[model samples]
Target chain A: MLYLGYCRHCGAGLLGLRRCGQGHLLVLCDECDALWQTSDLGQPPQFPPQPDLPCPHCGQSLNGPTAHWASLDEVRQAGWNDALIVGPGGCSAASAT
Target chain B: MRPGRRSVGLTLLGFGVLLAWLVVKPMLPTGPVETGQVRPETPNAGPPASVERPDGAAEQAERPVERPIDSAAGALTELPGDVWRSPGGLLYGPGSREGHRLRHVLRHARDDPDRPGEHGVFDGDQAAIVALIDEAYARSEQGAGRVERDGPRSVVTVDLQRRVGYVGGQVGRRQGHPATRHVRLVLEGRNVITAYPLRP
Candidate 1:
């Protein structure tokens, strides 16, 4: 399903959540040239390279997995919880109640 | 034959009685009369207000008062659904995650500029309730966002950022990072009962 929200990096008020071919969720921030996995099941899903799209924050072209995938460890290191990638399927790390 | 004196006297007495009756009618007490259609007691106009009764008792009376919008809004436990594990700062349900109504609410607020205090959920407005789960992850960083049940309603409060404020009496600390742009949401089942933003 497509979910819309804000892009913190560029403060753009839209972001979309879509599943790639492998059934993994991906979040693409077009304004920021950022595409990342919402799920961490396998290697983060790859999107077709967009050489023309430049990261709004750093002006880096988002063309490969190295530049686009948000590692699960990196997210955790940044102080984020594990719910994003786990989907609703059942991630036991945190309970929202 | 001319009217006898007795007949004329009797006629004068009857006229006097009629005049007396007219004068006294207005003076009589007209007790409360029931209208067959009882005006349904106008439902309390607004929030109940505290009023002083003649017996020196405090009572709740219906009055139009601008109820001070509470910064805390309402409790969370009132929401329809059983407590479920809060996953990734988003509270999920008595049912499956997709079926959880609150998921749409938090997502909608991510882009919604207008902070509607309390709102009802309509089928057509489901778009207003969608939030990107990825971004929700970023916002909940540093324990800044939280979702929990307050009563029957679910309360979701998120602190947008950490702020620096000067402290006065702390023996060792001179400054502290305060939470800023805190948004509290009170939800009932599938609807947003009220969303309050409180900054400390």
Candidate 2:
């Protein structure tokens, strides 16, 4: 339930549909990561952060929100599309912050 | 005066004159390089009698022109996912922002009225295609593009910066839905003469 504020891609706060490496809204987000691909799980889930993953395409550090934990294949597959992260359990009160 | 000494004195005098000439020449400013009054270089290899003739190499065995080292070097002749023809530019969707961007991307390229338009979705697979078009558009600041239907899907071709460019595949619906058509852009000359779109 921990509130993770990150731009999903650059770990930078969402830049209103952030421009990917190609300077286009390849993957964008609004109102937090809400505009990003939304996860379908009714409850929020918890995932560990891997701060070491740098995007191969743009060398941007990847240590942000749960959705930011995407691999190159996944990112490439979802060109300009936001990542959807839904967990089974609801966001814990402590994590919701 | 001894004849042998006189001869030796004359030799010394000549040497001194030559030394003085060398020293004065070094002190004087040298003029422009005059290669024998600028003769015309011809495979005819003969020196031209006239110095006034234009020396431009108009007729000569030419070497094959090499591509630019920055990008034209090791250029990709063809890509796998292609859908449309364009001069090379940005690919925008049907939305207003995207539309404006589309217009911006198309400013440099010309359209191929003869080639019928096709449509396809901008699937992630076609990112390369979009990237290619964007590159071209960036180069020319203008491009030609079109939107069409590929079967039940849709596709778009943005030719912005070059001549004889193309993109292919299907693109359907807007975001929130999975993009379908494969997008691509091929390079050509300074303008876009034609484009071809592929269907899903």
Q: Where does model 1 exceed 4 Å of error?
A: A1-97, B1-144, B160-180
Per-residue lDDT of candidate 1, residues B1-200 (tens digit): 36798899989999999999999999999986542222211211332233323221221131212211111211123223433222223433321111123332223222221212111111112121222221233354445577665334444566644321111112112223122344444444433333323332
Lowest-sum lDDT 10-residue window in model 1 chain A? A87-96
Write the residue-wise lDDT of candidate 2 on A21-84 in tens digits.
Answer: 3322222221112223233223331111111223334544222121232322343355633333
Could you tell me the TM-score of chain A in candidate 2? 0.20
What are the lDDT figures for the candidates, one per model? 0.33, 0.28
Docking class of 1: incorrect
Model 2 chain B weakest 10-residue run by lDDT: B61-70
Candidate 1 lDDT over residue span A1-97, tens digit each = 1223444332331233432222243566432223445433233323232322334344443332223233344334545554543321223223322
> What's the chain B TM-score of candidate 2?
0.20
Candidate that scores best on TM-score: 1
By summed lDDT, the worst window of 10 consecutive residues in model 1 chain B runs over B164-173
